[model samples]
Target: MLRMNINNLIKIFFLLVILSIEIGQSLIPLDRYSTSSILIDKKLFFFGGETVHNLKPSTTLDQILYLDVSKPFNTVNPPFEELPNTIPFGSSYAIAFPSSQKNVIYLFGGITVNVNTDLDDFKSILHSYNLETNQWTIPTTSGIAPGRRREISGVINNNTGKFYAFGGLSDQFTGTPNNTIALNDMNIFDINTLAWSKGSTINAPLPRADYTATLLSNGIIVFIGGRETNAFRDVDINQLALYDTKVDKWSLMTARGVTMENRFLHSAVLTPDERIIIFGGRKVPNDDPVLNQLAVLNTKMTPYEWSIPQVPAIDNMPLTTSAHSATLVGNYMFINFGQITPITNPQIQLPFFYILDIRNFTWIIQFEPEKSTIDTTSVNKSPSNSTSNSPDLPVEKSDNGKQIGIILGTVGLSIGIGIVVGFLGYKYYKKQKYKHAIPTAGSPTI
Candidate 1:
């Protein structure tokens, strides 16, 4: 009978093992996706980005490659493929403004040249690509555009069909010392009417390049840190300002994370929660600018507040870097491809990739990877007539992130169970060992 009982337990254990393996087959996680690209509206897009080795120049790609993010995970699906090389300004920080002027993507000022030692090699021209046609077209409008610049932001008032941009570094004349014109001017492009209009300036407006300004859903434009125009030396500004589109007025808003660190060429992503997530930018020394600290702000509250829940997370040198591209797909934030200028070693921004899922926003260092949820109802955007390709989201950690997580979890759980089972067994064993040894009234002791 005892042998039969043991045989029954063994059969049950094997059956459960087979069932768990079957269940795991249906669980496909996001980390398994190997593409280092980001997704918007279920469409994944990526181009070659900044690499480390600063002294060596990098290439600027002109094609936009995409994959459908909403598809079910399958081993047979093709990954990201180029969507005809038509879009202009495939460089970093090209001012991707969605919900702007009937859903258009604008490519603006960024470095077309990486001469290493020279700061004069920035581009000033602005280009826009129509998503419907997959074509790049320059705006035919009027204004003294501070072209060949960087650190500019574009926001669209879709209701008015007006797309606006302000603040960048560009010298209008045959001059030196790039993108520092001290012009705190506003330029707006009317996509519906196809025209340009310069905005009136705020009183005592500070000149800033490498600063960040984002248009909120409430139609308020908020600008963050940049190099100030206080020419007396040893003075860099980290002030916050705002512009209201409805009222056409600009003002300052007090915010945290405005430390002396200059946050130029960094990215500010408005999360699904309406909080802005900032990523790598250079921290300038002694008022000499550039920084890599990322600061997120919860500006939804009156008297806006900044949040840097993940600071000094990247445990590498040049801790805060600039000219990197970062975006949020789902709950995770993707930061990759940027330039880094070390104090002595000529600027080299290595091609580093990071995946910051929303859960890790509280504990970023131990960023655990999660599996992708297979929602059959989700609409994926493959080419209309072609089978959707599955370009995977990069697994920023080791390929074993998922496997390691499972191992750790199983070990942790098994250890816990073992401790409980051992304690119970010890109680049972001791009960049997000393059951007859108890000092009871009826027991005889020798």
Candidate 2:
């Protein structure tokens, strides 16, 4: 009877071990696209984008979703939580940044498109989201707000507490059609005074939207890769332009490394090492977009050269993604929610989040690579019939993420089971010894 009981316990324990492995495999979340994310107070905040199933009228997300970065990998319950107060307007393609003030972040300029007419009701409104208060407040400003625009990128000067807005589309292409003009004009918002002022644009980069701007340690805002026209056939600008806030001068930087792609809507982040890490974007839609690569600029160097590190296969980054938000936290860049391809398919949205370790160049997916339920509806865009002769890059093998997660989980669980088994065994032996010491029930008094 004792042998049978022990065998059954061992079998049940192994069964539980298998069940845990399965549960750990299902932790990864579905893919997301066309959203904005920011890291504030060690937490990642994601807002405003169309989900896979709810793409009709291009449903903009108002709910603020967040992930706690301090938790261990794959162990947090309630993977994402919604804030009590939502964004005033459900918008997509909006720019979000952390302000110099603690526990405060600013969101500006996103487009709400009409599904029936395919037009953008663009907004240039600025709303301050207080992480501490869990409230969104539209602070009144004195200066003229930039006219309705989308895809405009901005950087807040922490030193001056001023927000700078660069080139963006002033008018939606609906009314003017092909005559839509990209604004090269710069707008400044004084956070302290709550006023707006026009910044010097004497020699700014060509007026363009969908380009990225990053603030350098020397107070220069670097702009790169935006198209002159919305047409995919139109080549994107390749020059790396620099704007000096101190002198109010604009000039192009002469970079010396591998010829970087002239693409727009791509995201860039300033690494702790002072290098600008530019990831996936395309020169034109429908062409094989840049993939699984990092074009890094050594801004610390005199001439600012670009270098692509030879990372190992295990350290391979995720495949091509654009319109995504890459927020830096500690030593890792949390990249979640963005378009993975230039060509849109109603059925092809991947909503998973990834973490790129800046120190080791390894990629980690936060959730399982399962396809989430999304609107399998086609998005209307200016079509590009162009095809690329360049070879296709390798897709991300998500199995690696799954395998690594499983190994770690299995090891950790095994250690826990071993400890439990040893404890139970010792208890069982003690119980048997106590029974034997009873001296056949009646003889125990001796």
Candidate 3:
């Protein structure tokens, strides 16, 4: 009987262990947008962002979440690990880029939200995180820093060891009647010396933010469409602002291609062949038609040309994604969390990160393309006719919610079984003790 009881307890313990593993595997990070992420040595580290929960106010997240891209992982069950925070700091619209030196990532300006007051406080401080040490530090530096700002477009020239920060939504005029100012001034940061310096504002484009700044191989930075100083206007899509870093001069070039609508809050990634692929973004008005097509800009040509690629329609493809981080890893571009719909509707959580194989422009859910079918085709400049209506509700029900329900149910069942087994074991031990007990000099015996 004793051996049988021990066996039963052991079996139950193993069952609980297996259930716990399942719960852990199903767990994923919260839904977030405007998050900054950096890809270092095949590991993608996600920084501060605003998290959205059903029926609750959005919350700024301080936690650091990361995914190992070197290994093959399922999209539904992404193996994301959380790095412990040494100091708590959270913000949205921040930019994170890896240093030329290995194992270091630098986070620049962003806006911190005061949930209690529902106000935004812009930040201009610099924070550095060491992947090797797993430590975060605010490094002191000499020279003047840029004004408090968010949604700033920045890019690092690894050869020069400098980070170039351009136009952003500044809070310099916060107390003044203007209250909002778009900055076109350039700020330079020396990664090696930990110092800041202002760059030239000569012939800069109209003050803008929520744009993309891509660094070319020939020491030139290309600025794309963005929200201009006038909050309601977007920078013209036909003009490409080129900043020649070698001489610190700015010039505007006209791009030849199909007439494209103005866009902001979009993501752009440079291809090996000098093509800038522009992904999802929104127009000035949030309710306007969504920019669901991918725009490719060929920069190597004497005159820059734009083309809207025809991508095969795939189910569950994000029709609208803005304020998202897109990082290119080899042939695949990994798009992180972002708002899929207008801000007026409830934010829906995405179960998986979207992956695009730039080689053939195929949308994939898994990291490894071999596990899924790949329909390859040559580049076609044909326009996309696919149009998506602004979804009144979430596009798809989140699998995370169902997973949470399963975990909760399993926990409840586990606790109930534990309690019953514990009670039976106790009763059995008490009966055995009584049956084995010897009567001494008791006055009354039952």
For lDDT, the strongest prediction is 3
lDDT of 1: 0.52
Better of 1 and 2 by TM-score: 2
Estimate the TM-score for candidate 3: 0.75
Clashing pairs in 3: none
Superposed by TM-score, candidate 1 places the C-alpha of residue 231 at a distance from the truth, in angstroms, of: 9.9
Better of 1 and 2 by lDDT: 2
Question: Once model 1 is optimally superposed onto the true structure by TM-score, how far is the C-alpha of residue 383 displaced, in angstroms?
Answer: 19
Tens-digit lDDT track of model 1 for 98-175: 434443555655544433333334344666666677666766656565556544666677688887777665545655
Clashes of 3: 0
Best by TM-score: 3
15: Cα error in model 1, Å: 31
lDDT by residue for model 3 (263-377), tens: 8888999999989998877788653435644788999886899988877788847657777889887788888877654544443445238888899988877787342223234
- TM-score on alpha carbons, each prediction: 0.58, 0.69, 0.75
Model 3 residue 68 distance off true place after TM-score fit, in angstroms: 0.7
